[model samples]
Target: MARKAYSRRARVTGTLMLLVALGAAGCTGDPAAEDSPDAKPAGGEATTARAEPGKYQTLPQPCRAVETGTLDAMLPGLAQLDQEQRQKAYEGTSSVTYDSDRRTGCRWKVDSADAGHLLRIDFERVVSYSASVSDDARAQAVYGDRMKEAELPLPSDPREEQPERRADDSAKADRDEARATAPADDEAGQGASPETSEKPGKGKEKEAGKSEEPADETVDPSAPAEGLEPRLLRELADDAFIDDQLTTSSSGSGQRTVTVVFRTSNVIVTVEYEVQPKQVAEVPDSASMQEKARELAGLLAERLSDV
Candidate 1:
């Protein structure tokens, strides 16, 4: 009997210990269970956020970017210019870029009996250090700033209409008086109801009112002045504008400069072309210079996109 009781006691103790072990296991939770969202990942690895890389990793050699034929076409006076000056101009001067990948430029200038012409091409590959901001977006912001600085006029929307205001009080009063006298005249007319008489008379009066009202000389409030004209461009990069500046030198010769700025992806290209006619008081054609600059810009944009 004593041996059996001892055995029973041992069995009871084992049951209690087993229950305590299960309770401890339940309290601690499962070690091999699926991970909760709040917990760290399995391997303790973290993702490092980074901004997108610029489109062009390297820039074309600025001096060689524009071809010889293009230079000749852009500067008509190149052959007629002094030999020493023409040689110097043909070998364009390159900009000193610390990070050639980020920015570069080339410049050429020559003077002749026909005209003095200057051409400058600049390339800037935008880069953003912030992980949340992309290089292209940074470039877009810079472009917006350039547009604002140039004071480029936005294209007018045809849907937008402004109500004309009456500048003459006497004219408005006259129209009001005519409208008031119409009903009495219709009432006085035999067999002429107010509706019939007023309809035809009111039509005539409205026509007269329209004719008498002074035409408003509306002007685009956002347009830049005549001297500093900035116009939008198409068929180039994403967004672009051209600025035309005409300045007269002390010698009385006039110089017309056209600056074409365009953005493609993360790159911004600026082309500055100017023509100073040889004859005093003569001015370069803004349209002609703009076309030449745009042609050069398109070429640069094409090369940058290929890279």
Candidate 2:
């Protein structure tokens, strides 16, 4: 009976030792096991920033955004050629939009004797659903993408040429005034000293003065100045760009297209103007079309600002 009791106690001791060893193993976690996929963060959703509200809450009617006179100027002969056509041109086709306040567009076209013009204007009011991004920022992104597609030349610094030109003109005017007064002064001095004969010297001085004066350069309004190519514009809105392209039509006529895109606050505006002559060989002028398109864009931008 004593031997049997010793064997039972030994078995009990062995069982206790096995349990203790198992518990110690469980307590001492393995580094590799702790780094397993099961230990990773749940769902793995990264925190993001909240978006801001847009500046513009509403958009204007695209069809009537531009004035009748402006349309007439852009599309010449719309009123003169045909009444039906004039009505059609004045009342541009509005784009179908589920939410007019969010986005809208209008397009108009008019054909004259030898040439035709088309105009399309689009207005978009950006809405930010995200909590982190602002409406203006989103619009800027969209505008940036469009600008990339255009790949236009860099815009010229209007300030750079304008101030220089003004200064030059002022200097030229001052020189002219001085020259005009000089003749009077010379004549008066000569009259006072008629006997002191320096006529040859006076003539030489006048000729030298004339030679030193720079001749006025004739600047054609239609010509785009050096370095002032049609390009992505800045300071017009939050951002803006003008894209001008000349392409040959299927019939071999030259088609000139001028596209202007600008973003003001949370609203974006696009103006597309094109001119194509009936004769395939006749090429359209890019500078004139670009100017007209930019003017139209400016008008539309002003209207958006008012809204």
Candidate 3:
């Protein structure tokens, strides 16, 4: 009887212990598993992010990229040439480049009965050597350097006066200001005569003269026309600018060079159009040259995207 009683007691104790263990587990809740999202990934190191590469890896053929019709239009003298001569003129001589993929250029010079024309086009494909830097970033830096070298005018301020004359004007203005502010040489009011003393009307007249001084009347011979001043271009490409330079020879014949530069993706295109009149009395037109150069630049930018 005693053995039977002891066995029943042991069974009761085992059941009570099991129930307590289950209750504790329910209150505490289960620990997060290793595969949980909150846990670290298999590798301790995080993945490194990389920049996207440039859109263009190679450049188009510089000499053949432009259409023959474009050539004829830019070089109007082509119309006067014979069929064989025109065809030969259309095929421009390619500039020598060690690596054509990196940089390439083409230029043509033609003389007509009235004037001379020179056209040049250059294409550059920029590549980034650093893994952290992108090609587009490098190209932007390069384009900025070119812009600085070109000495483009500020956006808000227009260069109405010539560059070489600015210093002279500034000096003159400074001198006038100094004279106006300078005190009269230690005049003794006690002994001052009426003739030497500055009269009220005389001082007023002097001030009026300073205020009425005429502005610079001499126009810069090399300055572009009012609306044709060098400025930033818009809607032509990602970013572009046009500059017109007019230089006259001793004989008074002017040579005008219109340059347009733009960048698309990682490629940069430049167009240089020059016109030099043969006659001393003749001068190149600024508006027409700028238009032609800008048009060529826009066309080249579009073709580069397609390529």
Q: Each prediction's Cα lDDT score?
A: 0.80, 0.81, 0.84
Q: What is the alpha-carbon lDDT of model 3 when measured against the actual structure? A: 0.84
RMSD of 1: 8.6
Residue 84 of model 3: what lDDT? 94
The TM-score, computed over Cα atoms with residue i paired to residue i, of candidate 3 is 0.68
TM-score for each prediction?
A: 0.65, 0.59, 0.68
- Provide the clashing-pair count of each candidate structure: 0, 8, 0
Query: Best candidate, lDDT-wise?
Result: 3
**Leading candidate by TM-score:** 3
Candidate 1 residue lDDT tens string, 111-200:
777788889999888888888999889999999998899876676674563434333655799989987876444345666565555554
> What's model 1's overall lDDT?
0.80
Residue 50, model 3, lDDT: 68
- Model 3, span 7-56: residue lDDT tens: 99999999999999999988884466654666666687656666678899
Model 2: per-residue Cα lDDT at residue 56:
84
How far does residue 241 in candidate 3 sit from its true spot (Å)? 0.9
